[model samples]
Target chain A: MTDDIAVLGAGMHPWGKWGRRFVEYGVTAARSALSDAQLGWNDVQLVVGADTVRGGYPGHVAGAAFAQALGWQGARVTSVYAACASGAQAINTARAQILAGMADVALVVGADAAPKGFFAPAGGDRPDDPDWLRFRVLGATNPVYFGLYARRRMALYGDTPDDFAQVKVKNAAAGRANPHARYRKAVTAEEVAASPVVADPLRLLDICATSDGAAALVLSSMSFARRHGVDPVRIRAVSTVTPRYPRTTLDLPDFATDSAAVVAPPAIGFRASIAAAAYAEAGTGPADLDLAEVYDLSTALELEWYEDVGLCPAGEGVKLLREGATALGGRIPVNPSGGLASFGEAVPAQAISQVCELTWQLRGQAGGRQVAGARCGLSVNQGLFGHGSAVIAVR
Target chain B: MRTPVVAGWFNADDDPDGFRLLGTRCRMCGSVFFPRADAYCRNPSCAGSELDEVPLSRTGTVWSYTDGRYRPPAPYPGTPDAPWEPYTVVAVELAAERMVVLGQAAPGVTVADLAVGMAVEVVPGVLHQDAERTWTTWHWRPVGGPV
Candidate 1:
């Protein structure tokens, strides 16, 4: 409820296929963040790293990997995996440490040296895994679910293909100003339309690409921040909540949706669940957001995020887009960091990167893409396997 | 093949001729769940109550369709030695239950012939094979189109 932890530094390894080890990228970013905070790795009492399953060995137990990479000094190590939300969990872990007085200063890191082509699950025959069942049985890639949600919006709310394209266009323009963004060239709706359709109603460009990258943050208690003569933007709340069962609206990798027959589903959908937790903890609503950095895996998803974040009503998402309510100069700007729409998928680093964008924006340091006079910010992203990660920050 | 009642609804001893989708209906709330939620009712508004197995209507409208141009990973039971052949996936909205069910389409049915809102029916098929048996699953087929 209180804004107590100070975010002293945020840094990222530019997202793209560098063919380097994930540990290398994370160490680079961690050192950059440490330098940004004018501290040494030894001063960091805790280090948290987001795990990337696709990157093999070191990725699975990322906390220790990064700690070893940074030349371990016995910082407490913990590894938590929640698919894409791994980075947020890492951040949450470090926040808990600083908040509980477990440690005065903590380092959080997430990095991924991604595989080429479509993302896949670890090799195994585990019927217990729903993600595996969907791929083996339905071949439903993540984008397939995104397409389904997009088309469902069209069926229920009259969202057009053009409406979806506009999200990419806006984000692409903003991405041009982002030095760390993988795709820096501005894109047009026509370019989006002309791109090959990977899934019906969504094109190659409509979906974020696969990239190898890393992101890290330095967090500390208020006392630690002042002791170093370093000022920090404060982190007000972090939401690592999960969905209530009867997750009726179809989610990725589920063969059949949770039947509302067993019980009435929650009034809010999964993304709303993420934002709701942040709002409750921060004691603020969507109207209070100066800027937001959301997980825009696909263009249509950005629109869905608009409604889920409560910037607009459920079916009125496209209407909000149409009127520029979510654009750069709009009343409540969304994905002003250019979003995942331009950054591609880096798995573990993506969510942490969302926070990095906000930390920069909150400090008035996000030069070209800065949300004008921003004071409050939030990052909203849903991880696979029901983990909802949202963080609210205020200056 | 010993098929799971859940797997049977989508890809198992798929009796093609009498192809019926399976689901669970809450006796208390009259709401339905695809892939069958036999344990409980999903409507949070309804007090947790009894559930009954129900056959979903064989016919539903196409909500959307797409193909995985790339091969999906493990737990799907495909062999890397074999050249990857992509398959189409469909999401159908059952008007009867107001739910969207997802499944693979019958082999060879491309996205070319499918359109949103077109009527389709559920049929059964092989999901994967082992030395001993074929794992069955359900496939959605467009009515009057190629099988």
Candidate 2:
């Protein structure tokens, strides 16, 4: 496509509980990206950061935080927060700047030093804030939603718990080869079953943990990429869409869904729309995708993404799984980066990390977990409060 | 007397007929909100400014159900110093409002006891009891269960 931004470089400060300030991880990832792009920090014209709410004040202004940590160049800085979609928004902001002829080169960074255990909302008796209210009133944690989804799938599609465990097994196997992943050990279904249940139908291993990590990308205008004398993976489209009103499905941190009484529900659900928009913008379809890196916050959710991303029809995600279509060396491997199953979740950096995996796979650089002859790949994730995120990259 | 954990969420009356989860409905578009949107209607197509408080349907079908097997972190008011107890949660689809409302299942209900499409009804229940006050909230119970 003519409208494209070259991913000149991609890097990460591996996913784990490092316990350092989020800024430190951002700077390390940013420097690695700069090195990968064969450019210096001084060469970056713009810096875009995806914010982490847990990092206190500095995380709120993450763009400048990373800039300051990298010794302060006079780069135009922007910070964005969209919950888990923060990284995609950061990347989108940088791409817009580059495309607007405002900057030839832009750096995008996202990092997080997440808290341990079930993520809680900002403290307070704020009944008006749905995130806080859900906790205070319902005691509903993130895994609760995952459990509901998993159980619903089981009842509707006859998907057994064993089907869910296989997803963890496949992803962990992929993660074992990924040096940046937090958990390097391969998991078996027995191990997943043995883990204690955090929420009914979902065990500790089935759900992703909170982690500390960061990811960075060096992006530039296609013309700039040519001038730099490097052929690179290019972002064909970035989709950030909100659900159409009357959103009936229950999402995270919400007490209730938008009533579909007034208007008929949208033809496509919110999660499905994320990737549909990207495909529409790229003038491509699911068949054009060589691989995908979807947010597998829970192993069952990964199966949902298989349908949401149009790899299979609705209710057939488990069937696709049974056929081994989503596993590595199968048709259209998904979560070849181990996904949240192995890496846990560093919210702000996650979407960017997905794109980082896509960049590596598309460029034929993903050593052991590479999708052979991969050319086009997409990454999809949804953040709280109706933030939809998806990116399509091609080489 | 029971104090609501969050006032205006549901009626704290012990009478079964009087207990109903309170929400607001848009007069313009007939849309409903559980955490009651009194300010404006959320329907994008309608610019309804007036949302009237309405008692949601007392009975609904189970959309989905799960349980918190671990004690949730702070702000949940989990009992201090006591061992954690798993509690069931359910998402019930009110046919009248055509929206799903989430709440804790009636005391003692487990994940094994619930199923999708099973009929459930709202009931007044206690969330937690402080030294001076009993914090009240809504709970969903199977339609035929004890009141």
Candidate 3:
């Protein structure tokens, strides 16, 4: 145990285009998390907010925004932004404070109101900026990258579109049980094939959507949890790792793949590094993981995670999924509370939201969609730029 | 005007066909890098290392491929006056190096024709242009024939 930082409470304002200010969503989830912890906003000794690029500026300073929304009482405040991994980074920051005894209680919140259509790089004509150059020169969208992976799978392993569609079917069934998920009804493979093609070899169902939502967590010292009359599920480790040099593979919105200019990159992939850091810190391995919540931006990416996370050997991910090893009641179920497949990305709020799902499962509080014995759980997400996040939680 | 040969990235290209992507290997760690990291070694396990520049193989196998279906957003700097022309992107796996590299597919290639595992070679293509000069970049072309 890395000096268990108690999760006093977990909260969310659901996920979808609620059409409200992101601050409103954060405050709502904040109040809910505090109330669930049986503590008041006034009780938090520190505040950390995940930034979400407010129009014309980087997303608002979430710490002060939430503090002011809840009526500030002069708590230590911090703001962080790391694209998609902002939420997890926020949690990590809060954990550091509590573990260091700088504060006995803290609040962590992440919220975002995403823009429509494909995610675009910031507007500018800088030649050095690869994000803009890729889009301007090649016209690649996020789906285009997804399509490349899907096609590669077909070429290498003969993974049919039907195989990709089945991932949607399974995740949708789990999503139907998650009230917090945006798209709830069950999906079928035929339905997935019927959906319009967003990119070659990938369909609308294969890609996750952008959404507006907020999630918040109340974290505190173990002593603080005991003081609150709760023996809470604790966060064991938070992995916020970055990719090694020569990020050789192509990612979304980048013009040229990383140049192998100086030194060889890791044989272990970037995604694997996210999980490896968590497992090392949490003192656990894939064999000990009961459930895993990974960023499934595309179905192919999720299968890649299965291999990177060590749930299956490389080139055997499709085999693991087809054999029911990662299903609802299988040996090591994945995304038991639905997944990004059911809930489109809400950016800043997502990494924290993964923790919320793990917390629910670890406590045996996840009803209907519960894994039989989910004692230890892992959450994984990748941020744009160089950010990545993962968390390990235990009851 | 003859191209500047892009320095050490490729052999001095009097002909555009002479272009190839350049990379460096850590003399100390034996790790390879592309786009030519000239300053220092980046191996976490290696010391501030002496490096050697080496031209990468001109060919590899296609790992996967896709084509742009829509005009991309700005900062990509396509003028409002230019008609949007979609292009293909290919992820190529070099078995000798055991690494996957991505680049634009050569002109006229589309997703309909390219297959994974097909042999392809890297070649130079114009990235963009202004009144003064044209920017050069790398592209992958199908071997034998354009599919």
Against the reference, the lDDT scores of all candidates come to 0.82, 0.91, 0.81
Overlapping backbone residue pairs in candidate 2 total 0
Q: What's the residue-level lDDT of B144 in candidate 1? A: 72
| Candidate 2 vs. true structure, TM-score | 0.98
Q: Which 10 consecutive residues of model 1 chain A have the lowest summed lDDT?
A: A256-265
Model 1 chain B worst lDDT run, 10 consecutive residues: B5-14
Model 1 ranges with Cα > 4 A deviation: A56-60, B1-17, B21-57, B61-63, B70-86, B94-98, B107-119, B126-135, B142-147
**1 versus 2: better TM-score goes to:** 2
TM-score (chain B) of candidate 3: 0.83
Q: What share of the true interface contacts does each candidate keep?
A: 0.57, 0.88, 0.54
Residue-wise lDDT of candidate 2 within B24-56, one digit each (tens)?
988998888878888888888778999888999
- lDDT string for model 1 (A343-364, tens) is 8989889999998998999999
Residue pairs of candidate 3 with colliding backbone atoms:
A52-A59, A53-A58, A53-A59, A54-A59, A136-B76, A260-B33, A260-B34, A261-B33, A261-B34, A261-B37
**Candidate number with greatest DockQ:** 2
